[model samples]
Target: MRAGVCVILAMGALATMPWAAADCNPPMRPPANQRKFASQAVDSIIASYQPKFKDAQLGQIFANALPNTLDTTVFEHTTSGELAPDTFIITGDITAMWLRDSANQVAPYMRFVSQDSGLFSLISGLVRRQARQVLVDPYANAHQLEGSPPSPHTDDSTSTPAFAGTRVGAMGPTIFERKFEIDTLANFLHLSASFFAAAGKDQPTFGAPVNAAGQTWADAAELVIDTLRTQQASSEEEGGNPPYLFQRTTSQPTDSLQFGRGAPAARTGMIKTGFRPSDDAHTLPFNIPGNAYVVVALREAAAVLSALGRADTAASALALADEVNAGILAFGVVNHPGANGTVLAYEVDGYGNSYFMDDANLPSLLGIPVYGWTNTTDPLYMRTRALLLSKANPYYFSGSVGQGTGGPHDGLDRIWPMSMVARASTALSDQEVLSVLEQLKGSTACTGLMHESINKNSAGSYTRPWFAWANSFFGGLILDLAETRPHLIFA
Candidate 1:
């Protein structure tokens, strides 16, 4: 039976049934609406696994497991005019739904959309909000509310208007303002395209461009793609009206260009003109993951354009995708001096400098297959995966709990991100997958709540407690295991 239908049946049962009276601290009965809704939600998840559980004894365990496994509530938004409540945000820990995170969070649910209208609606709402955010600022790695504008800052200045009162600053003076992070934009575009493709729908309820703000989001996405193709930067030299410049009020240098220009030495390649996927300023700029995402985005854009009947635009996007793929294969893959074999370098200098670490983000080495950028069994990907999951990669760390990818974004020697573990498992099998699962199950700091980054030695010393992406990722991993390795669960 369909999961949605099962949920309605469960809801009917819960509504008619009376709860046993309890002598607890203030005996309480949840509102009828909440009780029915929660029961329905639990039932929907349980129904998805009903095929695997036939015995009444096993069915009870399966039914009870639904509440613990369902982190769907973490995605909910409470305030008015905000995204839907079921749309997962990264909690108080990250404070934003990274375009990447939003995409991954809803990705697994796409399979069930046809079976569950409520779940499909929730996913659709999330995709619409994400598309709107992409339209807001394609170059931005993150964004705040629609009512707020980003603060302006310069290369040398440290003070800038906070986005939703959250501080907005980067590392060096030359890399002062956050540049358009190509990877994030690509991820957003990819997700938008994927949502349209999977849901078999066109654009959401965005109205005609009668107002400036109404047109701004779509306009920005076009501009962002154009900027990437043309290698545009927030520069005063090419007409001072670039919409991407920022200047910090404090320590603003005399030579610093206000509207979004970076320091002089920072500009390197066509790739050097943007920020890293991590939202940190790139040291060399020609970021591997960013370029990989560009390839994926272009491919996705081509499909979207074709779906819209823009054949010429689709062809152009496909051509760009091919070009990016060629560039990545040519420049991004290289032999490490110590590692002997070639691995995907993190960042590349047009002049031969390459960094060899992975970050815990999509398009990172760990997420290549998860993002559908490459096949998991591809020879280069297999080699790169081996390197990334090992101590040979500077970011890889092994602890008593588990071994997985880490990065400078959180701290040195941190264990694997739960997201990374989930992605890694999705890509591979055998001992590596089992080990990652074991570590991840142990790494949940708040009982079963997944965190951003956990310390290598101690499971409790995690970074973000409320990160919904990690929780959703863990939930996805569970679902994947249920589907792929049913025997493991039974065994």
Candidate 2:
């Protein structure tokens, strides 16, 4: 594609240091022509850019990691035990596919789907598999492939049982982890719409996702509605308290909530998360960012279901979405001295108290605009975003190499590449985005891949060496800049 463009050469160890695992071993093989076409594209998109980005190390970083980071080396066909179409993808450093991770990992590559059918089908399978798992237990955030054993969660928490109001039929392994977070449902819904839109572009016959049972995506939407309503119920509310309890004998100082049943979150109309996206127990049942996310998720559900002619169901979902949105505007936004204005709280009890800081994860205040939950230019979000990136936010870290949000998941003074990506995605200025790119370009510590978190003070010191999500996120940012801020690329 760079056939006519004058290519520049990158200057650094990145240019000279050959990629250790640059190409696929046996090459990707798929029975379908589309899959084979995509296979070659996935395996060679980076190398194809080599001449075009000859002198640009950042470009080299994007080129080298986009495909290699998610190739057959890390993911193989789990059902057939080979590399081919619709194979389940595993997150790096683990064998199970997470509803959240799998979606984000394959997100950046969807741009190539119009050119390759295998990729479209593969992503379609991921969405369907996720929809199937939601039916299994809407509370489960991660799951194992069919016939595979349940992956242990250190067996920390037991979720509030899913109410069988509109439960769908039997199928699949139980679930890898059942600790519920609103983001899990949001992630699945977002992925469904994202895949459907992309795949349907080239394949006119492509239909909306349905679970193992012959249920449509609308049925899945109803499941979300019923489950969310049930989860929000309490002793005073219509459905009585959800009978979920988690008591671990470990010395991990877990959040052993009221014999595992969480404190009644007071029926705020806003959904409560059993755990944060960080996988840590919530200080309070009502999570601010998560509630904001539900508004987005349900709206997505509403839009999709409406298109499918499920009028009543779509209205029901939209009503619930509005309830959550109103809930966020009312209870979630509060004054914070750190931000010097009203901003979204991280977590809150319908009671007065709330945590003002943000986590590095989605539903995070910093990621609000990125998820389409809020406008990045909105005053409150802008103020909240400012505080999140500053020292005022307790988890906000500033070290030698970079500075951004972190979370309990990574410990103190650590910054997640995830947070950096969110920040860049919502950045107000070309300078701001470029600064983030500069911080990330050299933050990998010579792994030539991204890490879950890196030392803010030292670019090399980091954790989670095999985090596939962060690597893909970095690649996504590279793509974003190339599309939206190519001039920034020169600066």
Which candidate gets the maximum TM-score versus the true structure?
Answer: 2
Q: How many residue pairs clash in each candidate?
A: 16, 12
- How close is each model in CA RMSD to the real structure? 10.7, 7.6
Q: Alpha-carbon error at 385 in model 1, in Å?
A: 1.7
Q: Compose the digit string of candidate 1's lDDT tens values, residues 397-491.
A: 87665567766566676664654554545555656665665455555432345566666666556665445556556656656667787654434
Cα error, candidate 1, residue 156 (Å): 10
Give lDDT: candidate 1, residue 223. Answer: 52
TM-score to native of every candidate shown: 0.72, 0.83
- lDDT scores of the candidates, listed in order: 0.54, 0.67
Q: Once superposed on the true structure, which residue ranges of model 2 sit more than 4 Å away at CA?
A: 1-55, 72-87, 154-173, 201-212, 234-243, 254-258
The residue ranges of model 1 lying beyond 4 angstroms of the native Cα positions read 1-43, 46-95, 146-179, 202-221, 232-273, 419-423
